[model samples]
Target: MARKPGLLMAQLLNRFIWFDAALQKSLDIRGHGGVRRLESMCMVYVHAGIRRPSELARLLGVTRQSVNTALRELEAKGLVYLEPDPEDARCKLVHFAPEGAVMREEALDIVMALEAALEENLGRKAVDDLARLVSADWGEAPVIGKKGVGKAKERKKKSA
Candidate 1:
């Protein structure tokens, strides 16, 4: 098949990068210094109640080591602290540092402003529909073999 312009995955990734850059730029204007995308995402996940680095790795689809590294960076920035997990001695739980509260709250407010700006540009309904579609569970990937992708192509050929 010929390549198509504006594929769904590309569009989604482009929008993601756009928002990520926008957030970073807004943070910079507030004199918060530069924050990497992964680091910022880690903060967001931590605020959402994902305490363990292992769970954060799972949610981010990254390795546990990556999550640990990001957490360490956050610790260095005084944005978060990691403590020994009470339930599991081998694990550590993430928490926002006392000094980090102001920055965290400011980042959240920036996100809300970004969303409001999106709604202004795209309309509230469009933004709501985008959120709903992106959040909806689409299930697992196809097996893609003798009975999967090949069969799909065969059906497509017949329809054509």
Candidate 2:
């Protein structure tokens, strides 16, 4: 609770690294090789029955456009079907096709393999806790990062 700035930053960086590794490796297994990483993950989840584009965007910490783009690609690939919402035609309810189920099962296995890798280093309890922490707070809060803050800016200041 009373974390030092350095400690908090370290935890944030660690979460970034672990999550990136988990999601990216899973996407690569799909071999669409042209796929956007996060979007592929979104498609897999949708195939698993998570539907709403807004919810997918919330889950992935991305914009709705990003999720929609991914869905469009997945649909074009014959993996998903998006029916215009009956009550809200502006929204689409994404559902997977039979072919989509095949890919979903494959992606699920890839994710499991990545989970095993994390367990090999961090044990299962720690891994589960990390997942729980992620699910509970997936970008529901805002970041107060300073504008124009970067290593480039710091290097320029040092040179000056």
Q: Pick out the ten consecutive residues of candidate 1 with the lowest summed lDDT.
A: 141-150
Off by over 4 Å in 1: 1-6, 141-143, 149-160
Cα miss at 54, model 2 (Å)? Answer: 3.6
Query: What does candidate 2's lDDT look like per residue over 1-160, in tens digits?
Result: 5867668768887776676566666556666345566656776577567888888988788899988888888778877788988878788898887776666676667767878988999999999997897579444344333654365566667999
Question: What's the TM-score of every candidate structure?
Answer: 0.83, 0.63
Point to the candidate with the largest TM-score.
1
Give candidate 2's root-mean-square deviation (CA, Å).
9.0
lDDT of each: 0.87, 0.73
